[model samples]
Target: MKILLTGISGQVGWELQRSLMSLGNVIYMGRNQLDLSQPDTITTTIRDIKPDLIVNPAAYTAVDKAESEIDLAMAINGVAPGIIAEEAKRLNAAIIHYSTDYVFDGNQNTPYRESDLTNPQNVYGKTKLVGEEAISSIGVNHIIFRTSWVYGLRGKNFLLTMQKLAREREEIKVVDDQIGSPTWSRMIAEITAQIVAKFQQNPSDFFSNKGGIYNLSPSGKTSWYGFAKAIFNDDFSNNERKLQRLIPITTQEYPTPASRPAFSLLDNQKLSDTFGLKIPEWDQALKLVLDS
Candidate 1:
């Protein structure tokens, strides 16, 4: 089967290129080749490629910047995916889109389920929710994966940021009040490939019975401070650059333009039960990333 993969430059997209390759032919495109900001370009690309599946791992991910650049954010995060979904419908192809945990307002103390109501507190989350609604309205075969706290070896993510800071600075401050699972992009790609293989083996079983949103994250949770401490302990043990002071602070102390969910952990029971898949612990996944 021929698959069209977008956001080839992103961390998840980069890993997905390798995982999806075993299944069939994958035509990868980055923003330069297929910019999400251009609706006509997305429609034309999908029409021209005529892929059996379209894996969209791209979005306007500037969470804090979205507050200032609402139009650009909405165009890429909200409007573009809608056009892709519409085109996929016309081509009778399946679409796989990635969302975020920010869709929730962070009020719930327990892990979030797929059925939980979404009340985004920030502009970035609102636009992503809009994208989800658009895809749902298209009435096509699509699977939306909501993930949280994604990190990887490459790309600008929390893990890399912490690593760089540990090397350059003597001390660092991280938010301890907010908690979520740290997902490895590699795991996301692997799970996505597994889902695609399942569908390929039994297309009717998936299409006629199951095809909807599912939370794709690691099994455990941690705060930003904990995550950073773990990284520092693992990456630099005896070096002079080892983190000397990791000051834990609240979200309000280190404020950004976007308001993040206080507790963004997602329950994976639905995804595991539906796909017969098991995710590793967040720390194990982090180790794998660091090792790689």
Candidate 2:
């Protein structure tokens, strides 16, 4: 199979290169090659490649910065997805897109399901939801894996931020109220590869009854503070950081322009039922990333 992948420089995309190598002839494209902001560019590139599958791990993920870059965010996160879906439909190809848990407001006490109502509280979430809608509306064979708290070895994510802060400052203050699964990008890529391989074996069976939005977060959830502590304790040997203390603070104390969901835990039962894949808990996955 010929595969076209976007966002080759992102955390998940970086790992996807390794995970998807054995699947087929993989073509990797960064923004310079196939800029999502330009619909014409995306159309030209995808048509030229004519891939059997399109895997989109690229997204405008700046939560707070998206508030100021609404047009760019919408173009990439909202409009670009529809463009890709349209092209994929023409080529009789399938797509696997990654979305986020921010689509819902933090009102539910339990984990969110695929059918949960989406009321994005921030611009980033709203735009991502638009992407999901665009792909689904196209009626193409697709799987939208909505994950949360994604981080990896190389990326401007919470893990790297906390690791840097731990080394630079003696005390680190993190928000204690906001909660998520803290998924590793490598895990996401690996699971995606597995699903793709499975789909290749039975395309009709997979897309007929199983293609849809499925929560792909780690099994367990934790506050930002707890997540940071896990990183220090599990990721580091001998606690070898300059961090002396970790202060748990409220979201109000460290306000940002983008509003965050207080609890954005996603339920992964549908994923298990469909793909027979159940991601491990946050702590377990963190160890795998750190060890690698």
Candidate 3:
């Protein structure tokens, strides 16, 4: 199988390169090579590659900065996926796209399901929702995985930020109100590869019958404060960072341009039942991330 992957530089994309290589020949492309902002470029790239599967992990992921850069965000996150879906439809290639938990407003008390109503609070969420809508409307063979709190060793993510802060600062304050699972990008890539392998084995069953949005996250949830504390505790045996000193603050105190979901935990039962794959607990994945 020939697979075309976008966003080679991203956390998930970088990991996907390894996971996807086992399945078949993998062609990785960065923004410079396949530039999602340009519909013509996306079309040309797809035509040239003619891949059997297209994995799109590229996105405009600056949650706070997206408020001021709506046009840029929408183009890359919203419109680009739509164009890719259209091209995929033409080529009869299956698409795998990554979405975010920000698609829903954080009003619900329980974990969000695949069928939950999406009412994004910020521009970033709205744009991601638009991308999901575009894929759904195109009526093609696609699977949209809506994940939360993604972090990896290579990218500018929460884990890296916490690691940096813990090394330099005496004390760090993290938001305690916002709650979600800290999904490792490597896990996401592994799950994507598993799904692809399944498809390769039974293409007709995988594409014709089962293809829709599924919430892909770890089993448990944690606040930003708890997550940071866990990171410090797991990494430093001497406790130099002093996890106890890591202060917990409310979201109100740490103000940003975008309003974060108070709780963005996603229910993974649907994904597990559909794919026959169990998501590891956030703690289990956190250890692997720290080890790396």
Candidate 4:
């Protein structure tokens, strides 16, 4: 199977290069080779490659920056995905796209299911939701995995930010009011690879019966402050310098241009029920990432 994987430079993409290798001829595309912001480039590339499956983890992920750069964000996050799905439909191929938990308003106390109504509060979330809609509207075989609070060692995520701050500053402040499951990027990649492998086994049945949106987050939840605490607690590297105290602050205390969902925990029950993929806890995934 010819698998076209996008966002090679991203944390999940970087990990996917390794996980998806055994599946088939993985044709990896970084931003330079396949920029999602450019629609013609996306259409041309997919047409040229003619992959059996297109696994897109790429998007305009700058949550706060999306507020200022709405057009650019929408182009990549919203328009590009529709183009990809269209191209995939032409080739009679399937697509696996990654989405975010931010699509919800976070008003509900319970974890958001796949069937829950999406009311994105910020530009980034709105754009992501638009992308999801675009793909589904195209009437193609697709698997949209909605994940939450993704972090890894390589990327500029919350995990790396917290670690860098811990080393440089005497104290750090993280939002405590907001709740989510801090999923490891590698875990996301691995699970995605598993799904792809399953798809390869029986593409027709997989798409006919199992194609839809599923939450792909780890079990359990925590606030930003709790995640920070877990990261610091699992810091196994010998180079420890500063970080005297860790301060927990409310969301209003640390304001941002983009309004995040106060509670964006995604329920992964559908994923387990369909794929039999039992993900680990958020903290457990964190420890594995740190250990590596």
* Clashes (candidate 3): 0
Q: Which of the predicted structures, 3 or 4, would earn the higher TM-score when compared with the native?
A: 4
Expressed as tens digits, the lDDT of each residue in 123-197 for candidate 4 is 999999999999999998999999989899887899889878878988798899999999999999999999898
| Model 2 TM | 0.97
Worst 10 residues of 4 by lDDT: 234-243
lDDT of 1 at 181: 95
**Listing every candidate in turn, what is its Cα RMSD in Å to the true structure after a full C-alpha superposition?**
1.2, 1.5, 1.6, 1.5
lDDT of 2 by residue, 176-225 (tens): 99978898998899999999899889877678778989899889889999
Tell me the lDDT of model 2 at 63: 92
lDDT of 3: 0.92
**Model 2 bad stretches (over 4 Å):** 234-240
TM-score of each model, in listed order: 0.97, 0.97, 0.96, 0.97
Could you give candidate 3's per-residue lDDT for residues 1-292 as a string of tens digits? 8999999999999999999998999999998898887888998899999998999999999999999999999999999999999988998889999999999999999999999899999999999999999999998899999999999988899988887777677678899999899999999999999999999999976877779999999999899988988887744545555333578899989999999999899999999998899889999999987776
Which pairs clash in the backbone of model 2? none
lDDT of 1 by residue, 54-166 (tens): 99999999999999999999999899889999998898888999999999999999999999999999999999999999998989899999999999989999998988888
